[model samples]
Target: MNIVVGITGGIAAYKAVGVIRAFVLLGHDVHVVATDAALRFVGRPTLEAISRNPVHTDLYEGVAQVRHVAIGQAADLIVVAPATASSIAKLAIGLADDLLGTTILASSAPVVVAPAMHTEMWVNAATAANVATLQSRGIRVVGPGTGQLTGSDAGVGRMVEPDEIVAAALAALRPRDLSGRRVLVTAGGTREPIDPVRYIGNRSSGRQGVAIAGAAALRGATVELIGANLEVSPPPGVRLTEVSSAAELAAAAATSAASADIIIMAAAVADYRPEITTQSKIKKETQGDRLRIDLVKNPDILAGLASTRHRGQVIVGFAAETEPDDSALLALGRSKIVRKGADYLVLNRVGWTEGFAVPDNRVLVIDLAGDIVMEASGSKLSVADRILDLLA
Candidate 1:
């Protein structure tokens, strides 16, 4: 794959080197285009040496071959890591003043930006609006996770890890394993509303589901993500159907799975919901020592989907267990796979060190035939891709 990496001006510009190295290590032919401001942070010689290709920083550097258009048009994927606020705004508005911008303008390949900026800049209405515009056009944004920034301040707007950016870029270029295939993916922990301001939910942060959806889309599948009340944003290009309660998720999953090629029930749906939602907030009363509420079982979305799946369609379910031993955990997954009638099941151990709300994960993919196809221990995206590879 021919990867074109763009580096813009930012304190995080140095991080793009690692991004380039990762792609190169994967045997990708990488070419780099750095903007003038980016050069101030990381010099052209360094990029040239690492990429093993002539680094293009000036739009006029190679006018003989119309280098900007040549580079862009030939790229399999364009990745702009450490994309600064200024660069983001420029790209959003179609600015072509520099090599990076010009190349992007001439390219037909997918463009992915890993943004890095101060919290204030990232949160500004202008930046937010620009990001929305780019996403609406199918441009991919990896991350600006909340963390320590360039300065003493600590908050959102820090760029994601370089390897993550590389993984996302590579995923974009890989064969669409799910192309034309309809996949129904459930995400987030369902929120059972108790009142207007209160709800029953879990600790699920939806990161795993989001990663699955993103990975599925990159494999060329048409994915319908049934998202519960989530704290994080869904990846770009997945069709999202937002729901707040377990009932809503069940309904959505049932409806969407009608035409789906695969159903992945990854959401942490609440087992029970309040029988009756109060019209207003339930206040603490003097006799609250014996307060009680009736609960009802929510619909079983995965079981329901597996029961009526079409011929050849696959059903994948997730099971998060708190078992202490590997044999017990595998046993739990085995039982769930049989009981749920799923074609495959992913067993994840959840606790302070394992799954749930974390970027990395360790999982076992168990099939209905009692075959363990793969045991993954890495980033969620890596696990998701491995699953897709088996399915593909």
Candidate 2:
């Protein structure tokens, strides 16, 4: 993919370096086009070094090649990170006063804009009107998240993280099959507390669940992610609810499921939790060599959702097995689908190296009747997209 990254003037412009590197690392040909003010924040040398291409900031830099119009015409996608209120107004009004503006005006490829500015500026009537105008013309806006900003002031105008911008850009290029739908996903291993300092938890990193939520959001679903101790940041554009125990996860899942069109039980929720939680930390020296703790069964979130789901709602469950053989795993998965009353279940072999903390996954999607609906092997994101495909 050929991607054009437009950087405008903002303190967040410095973060655009990561945005460029992210696209390049994803195997895309990246070109950085910055405004004069953007160059003041992130220099030409740095952008050139990361993108591995000559940075363009002037409309006349490559007149022989007609670079201004040519670059945009040939782009597969255009992403403007740290898009300032100034740049937003320029693009909104079809201004071509600068190279970045001219190139954007000429581009026919999908455009994704990530806005960053002070909270007041971002919410001003003029900026809001410009944003509405741009979106009315089919331009996609990523975010201006609320957090610490340039100085002592902070609110809704912080630029989202670079990986999120990349995710949004890629999402903009895909089909919007899940648009207008609400999706609920759970990820990470639930941690059950035994004491103030001691707890039981699984090795789940939440990569697969995050991937599914991301893919669903990219496909246009309004996603609510119930994450439990995730090893990674939740994907951009999803509402995140963080939890630490099975009970908390169960409550979150049950609450969000009421309005979700699709619900995925991808979290590695503990089947059991410590029967008793001590207020004080357990000490090794005081209770030398021996330890015992009772366990209690956790509510089956997936089964409960499946049983009470609306007639047209779809519920999916995930089964991680160490059954050691394909036949056994398949049998277990088939039985689980029926037992849980879920419309679909994803079954995967997991152990120390394969599923828990890894980036890729191998899985079989089994339907309620024990039929294999889809089998996939690749990065968790790919698996996520396939799951959505099946849902569609």
Residue by residue across 83-111, what tens digits does model 2's lDDT show? 99999999988999999988988899999
lDDT of 1 at 370: 71
Per-candidate local distance difference test: 0.86, 0.91
Model 1 lowest lDDT segment of ten: 20-29
Q: Report backbone clashes per prediction.
A: 5, 0
Off by over 4 Å in 1: 1-36, 39-168
Please write out the lDDT profile of model 1 over residues 155-186, one tens digit for every residue: 99999988678767767667866778888888
Candidate with the greatest lDDT versus the true structure? 2
lDDT of 2 at 113: 96
In angstroms, the error of model 1 at 329 is 0.6
